[model samples]
Target: MKIAVVGCTHAGTAAVKNMAELYPEAKITVYERNDNVSFLSCGIALYVGGVVKDANGLFYSSPSELQEMGVNMKMKHEVTNIDTEGKKIAVRNLETNEEFEDTFDKLVMTTGSWPIIPNLEGIDLNNVVLCKNYQHANHIIEKAKQAKKIAVIGAGYIGAELVEAFEVYGKEVTFIDSADRILNKYLDPEFTNLMETEFENRGVKLALNQAVTKFVGREGSVEKVVTTEGEYEADLVILC
Candidate 1:
């Protein structure tokens, strides 16, 4: 049987690797838009804080490794559409823009979570970004070069770690959250309290329960972060 896999993150990478080893006779094809695969986005903060100096430490697997295991690895390839009726997928080479159709007896989709896009005034301005991939992490560092005050939105895993990293990098940071506390979805109030205290002790601004009304900017760049409470100056804005 022939199998086609879309995406090559945690889920897709595992599926393709297991299938190729378990069923060597069965043909397998893996499509990934990124040049690299199986990146541990969770470790980005460590990378940023200099805890992990090697950028390769963030990647879990490579396309060449999969190819060596008898899997047909197609990097920089993006699937445009799926023809479920015909058991084929329409795909394009992102680098070449060449389109092609591939047939398969089975299909597996492991598309991961997407970064949320918040609609706010001046959000489209420069230096506003999301920390989701390698490119994003690199962009964050690049933008920090000219920024004095950085504002990070959301209080999830990425947000918390990003703020911590910024503080370590000597960048004045203020974390904004709409909820009453940080990590409300995961940790209880008591544990969250410990974390809050740590951030506060480190001189990181924990702006909680403050709903952002808009992003005020000038010259197409972020100038201030406006919320229900007041406006805070920000040279760079990030969402995670």
Candidate 2:
């Protein structure tokens, strides 16, 4: 039997490893758009806050590890098209810009989620970034180091955590969200209220119940965040 797995994140890595062990006789090929696999994205805040001393520690699995399990690990390979009926897929080698096709008896897709970016003015300006994967973590850490005033445009788990991290790192952080409270979707008002108080005590500015209307920049770099309630000065903006 031949199997093809698209994506090599947590789920993809788990599926590939389990299948490789359960069906030793089967041939498996894993396609990953990124060069690395199985990154612990939840720890991104810790990493950005200097809690995680090594960036390499974020990755739980690697291509070489998967390859050792008798599985073909195709790093930097994207599955451009999948023909389910024909059991074939068109692939592109990102490094070489080469395209090719491969046949598989079975297919598994574990393509993960991406951050939702709003269509706000000046969003594409420098220092406006999204937090989702390994690359974003590194970018945030790098940008946070140079930014005096940092603004995060989401109050979810990641956004709240990032704001706290930035606050501990001595950066002036402004936490913004459309909802009335931080982590409204994940936590109850009681919990969020306490968290809000804690954050406020640490001098982290909370801009809840305000929707971001636009981002203001000077000379192609972000300078301010304009929200429904008010505008705040920001040297770096992170859209969680």
Give me the candidate number with maximum lDDT: 2
RMSD of 1: 1.2
Q: Which portions of model 1 show Cα errors greater than 4 Å?
A: none
lDDT of 2 by residue, 133-236 (tens): 99899888888878999999889888988988989889998999999999888989989899999999999999989899999998999999999899999999
**Which residue pairs overlap in candidate 2's backbone?**
none
What RMSD, rounded to one decimal, does every model reach? Answer: 1.2, 0.9
Against the true structure, what is each candidate's TM-score? 0.96, 0.98
How high is the lDDT of residue 12 in model 1? 88
- How many clashing residue pairs appear in each of the predictions shown? 0, 0
**Per-residue CA lDDT of candidate 1, range 42-144, in tens?**
9888887788899898988889899999999899999999999999999999999999999999999987878979788887988888889888887887788
Evaluated at residue 191, the lDDT of candidate 2 is: 94
Runs in model 2 lying further than 4 Å from the true structure: none
- Clashes counted in candidate 2 amount to 0
